[model samples]
Target: MTRPKSTSAHVQPTLAQLRALIAVVDAGGFGEAAAELNVSQSSLSEAVGKLEDLTGRPLLRRSARGTVPTPAGLRAVGHARSAVQAAGDVLLAAQDDSQLSGVLRVSSFRSGATYLLPPVLVAFRQQHPAVTVKLLDGDRAGAGEQLLRSGQADLALIEGVSAVDLSLTPLLMDDYLFIAPESRGTQPVTVQELAESPLLLSPRGDACFQRIETYLGRLGIDTSSATEFEQDSVTLGMVRHGLGITLMPRLALLPVPDGLVLLPLPEPLSRPLAVATLPWRARLPLIQAFTAALVASLGSASGQTTPLALPVWNQSPKLEPEARG
Candidate 1:
């Protein structure tokens, strides 16, 4: 395993250098970062060179194949971004003694922004009136994970596993409902029936939708008969409008938009809504509080347990050093 940039050297990175490094990594090359940063490639290279000297390791590999982060480079970027963010938080902490005002950036997918954010943001604003919060809905595959990893977002309310290394807090248990017009009839629909029926559902790329697809796949039913739409709201509208029947999260029914009935799933099909961030960022008060609030909100929504059961531990054989030795 490659180690991240060392902080033991006590060589402080300036804000300018931190930004330059993040930009280079995000843009995938210094030349591109220079264009985005409005600086010459030579200037960007100089900054990276200085960063390499400071960190005592090369951060990027460049060639006609384009740029790739060296093992050290990936670690350096993660640490560099974390360090820069910590510095900003420190400054904010100091400022809070006089004025408790700052920007809180958050990112999430549509379902999160729609069903999850309204109450959380409302409550957070009520508590932190001085702090300004901005929420952006993102594409699950690319932009959502990018915002968190790039240090562009303070807290990210993502679904799951865009990448493997993310440490996540289980936020809510979503009950999947098969929705149809009350006029459509009351009988429960099976996976096979829905596969062939006219289905109004969000695009395949949506996280919860993908989970439903996996469930369908598990049942060995092809989703070729499904008709894709923009989002749950629109799809729900179509269902209400009598266009087709579809699956939607139970929580997504807030306000219980009329003209439709939510049918129960034939099997247990639960999806998790989660809060995610770097594991090392676990201790920050903002992160801690945000996580607590989400879990609490989920509990309140469920009306059963305040927190989920104590997290289960893995039951596996421990690796023995003697086996390797």
Candidate 2:
């Protein structure tokens, strides 16, 4: 028998090191990741440092803004995610099938979670009492897509179908409504009139803001002088005080605050909200169960007489999404 060539320089990384690197990248900083993972920041740093040493490459770009993964670090983190997911799958596979049980990590924007998820969650709990569902904040633009792609979340409820890479199941169509104080009357405002008015914009760097900006800009509206607010509540308060008029999706205006009136814009715009997941994960029993529950819950609420299609994981040509109610 021939002996294999002698080689000993390569050192495999421990699961802890892999997890630390992934957590830092996902959470955007060691401090944040440490807090989320309930570990000391120093220990998280140490694990990432050791991982870098073992891999023979710099894995993080640390600076004042925050820590971000280096190019090599990103590649390493991808493999790390696969390894971690595989380990999780092993545990799930070994569990008894008497009751489907596992963690389903979902990332969703605040509006969707607050207004659309409660009923769906209630149904899911009734069906799978043993499963645990964890919700992560995905309020910022692209947060949901990134979380799912990075393996941090199993499901992501995001606005719009921009994330074509994932399997998307449209849940609702939220129309953009012109919002102003009731004192402003219920008259429909045209784009030119809106531009002339003081427009209070939503928090910057979100899908809602981006869509509104693009739509208004195309219509020759100059938003340069528009004041931006960090919180939706603050924006609504300002609108109530007649500081400016604003645009908001229907869902975000749930339980419309007293003294505010919502009117349809002369030129309508709408958001197609959808639930997304990795194509393969859509077929998992836990995800499928959730999907069925979501369809049943939302479908019932919308008074849809037709049966909505439940999610089925496949890579065939995409079908036209069901008409948004």
Maximum-TM-score candidate: 2
Off by over 4 Å in 1: 1-13, 21-79, 89-101, 139-146, 160-164, 307-325
| Cα RMSD, model 1 | 11.9
* Candidate 2 per-residue lDDT over residues 65-88, each given as its tens digit: 789988888898999998888788
Candidate 2 collision pairs: none
* Pairs with backbone N, CA or C atoms under 3 Å apart (clashes), candidate 1: none
Model 2 / residue 108 / CA error / Å: 0.8
Error of 2 at 22 (Å): 2.7
Candidates in order: C-alpha RMSD to true structure? 11.9, 8.1
Error of 1 at 38 (Å): 12
Candidate 1 per-residue C-alpha lDDT over 1-325 given as tens digits, one digit per residue, 9 for 90 to 100: 2325656687776777877888888788878899999999887888777777777777788867678778888888888887888778775645533244678777887667887777777776676678787886674655666777777786777655345556687765566777787676666667666766686767777676688888877877677678898756788788888888887766566556677776667777876657777666655656665667677766765454744422222211111112221
**How far in Å is the alpha carbon of 247 misplaced in model 2?**
0.6
